[model samples]
Target: MTVAGEWIEKITGPFEDKKRYREYKARTKLLPESHRTAVEALDRYLMYFGSIGKSDVLLRMVDDLIDLFERAAADGTPVRDVVGEDPVEFAEEFLANYADGMWINKERDRLRRAVERAAGEESEKEGESPR
Candidate 1:
């Protein structure tokens, strides 16, 4: 599903409004990849907390995050510094300010494992140990 559809499903439950979802999906596709990913992550974070209904706050937070990233990129901050070599740690740290539950703990472990697996695959492609 498109990020928009995924968000809509999260907010209103499955298959709530196909037309509006499609519209949002199309609009989302127009966003830059970085912006899209940030928005998606924010959506997932809010959904995990069952706060998707708070669209206004979520939107503002996502916008602020995107702005921060954009400014950092403009200032020549390395992507690794922004997202970290371990995306799970970075994600957990970033979400810590917004999240307050056991869900984040489990999600952090899952994210870490997924990032480590991806890094391992990349290392293999480069003929190096994951280390």
Candidate 2:
């Protein structure tokens, strides 16, 4: 597995197993609130991981996460600014940051494809009738 695959797996795999998720949440709670952005993102990643339940998806996101941190650190993105704000805002900025990153274009494309696929399935189910 790639580094990205390993990262995503480490973050998401635990949560898939009942006992592991409990342990993960417990361990995560011990982390400072200042790390909330990263932690919350990790949590959400786990959620998405469960939703997709695909190892490839998790692998892609793992690479994306590393790139996001490196860029955030190099540009001096305040950790407090991300983690200390509203949850909604944090998610928006979090996704946008990844959307705008250079190293994870494939992951971004993967997300777009997923969204498009969902939309297409919904549209197909709705038939040819106009909205």
Candidate 3:
């Protein structure tokens, strides 16, 4: 992307995320009650905690979510069957598959680099000590 485009995304991401999320919401409404409720609850958690930054990645994730729920509704699969027993684990695993633009991952990388740097400096200090 050009510098201008990056700047524009920084400015507001064109507020397009809202539009994509709205589309996801509208599509989810067509799902069966059980599927819709479970999807919506999962959607809420993902939105609040996803920490995804790129608009396109978020859109893709939302679209994939709709696709999954739609198929489940069509097959009359139980929500528990779709998500297994632990919803949080399922949600986290779902998020893990889509790693693009995840702020948490960026933070984790930053932390790893910082720790490595600190460790290197500590080793240097120890090496400089009198034998």
Candidate 4:
């Protein structure tokens, strides 16, 4: 017995189009071992923390990640130099640049709206400004 919400989600869930993700995985395979390992670590981090909501933006971010590793591999650049000592910081900084694609941005907007309503700064008016 499938729920209506489940059916609706099946038709409109995030990442329904996975072609770009497949391509990203293929590209990752071509990198040198060390670069590939660095990428895998960053990919794992991004999957858990990036929370990119838009498919196009996620694809772009992955493509860019591939591009950076590919260039570093070609140039014989060390993986440590590529990701730096604090990789979590590097991954987070990379994610910060793509703020528009992050799900947290939506939650932040919702939080702001709720806070405004509670504080009487916002009204129940249908045409009220988002800010």
By TM-score, the best candidate is 4
Return whichever of 1 and 4 wins on TM-score: 4
lDDT of 2 by residue, 1-131 (tens): 88988898688674345454454456555544544357657658545533434444444544454455445555677665544557556554545533433335667788877786666754555575323
TM-score of 4: 0.78
- Where model 2 places Cα greater than 4 Å from the true spot, the runs are 1-41, 48-50, 80-84, 88-131
Higher lDDT: candidate 1 or 2?
A: 1
TM-score of 2: 0.34
Candidate 3: where is the Cα deviation over 4 Å? Answer: 1-12, 15-18, 121-131
Deviation (Å) of 24 in candidate 4:
1.3
Candidate with better TM-score, 1 vs 3: 3
Task: Please give the CA lDDT of all the candidate structures.
Answer: 0.58, 0.54, 0.85, 0.85
Clashes per model (N, Cα, C within 3 A): 0, 0, 0, 0
Return whichever of 2 and 3 wins on lDDT: 3
**What is the C-alpha RMSD, rounded to one decimal, of candidate 2?**
11.2
lDDT of 4 by residue, 59-128 (tens): 8889899999999999999999988999999999998888899999999999998888887677646566
Whole-model lDDT, candidate 3? 0.85
| Clash pairs, model 1 backbone | none
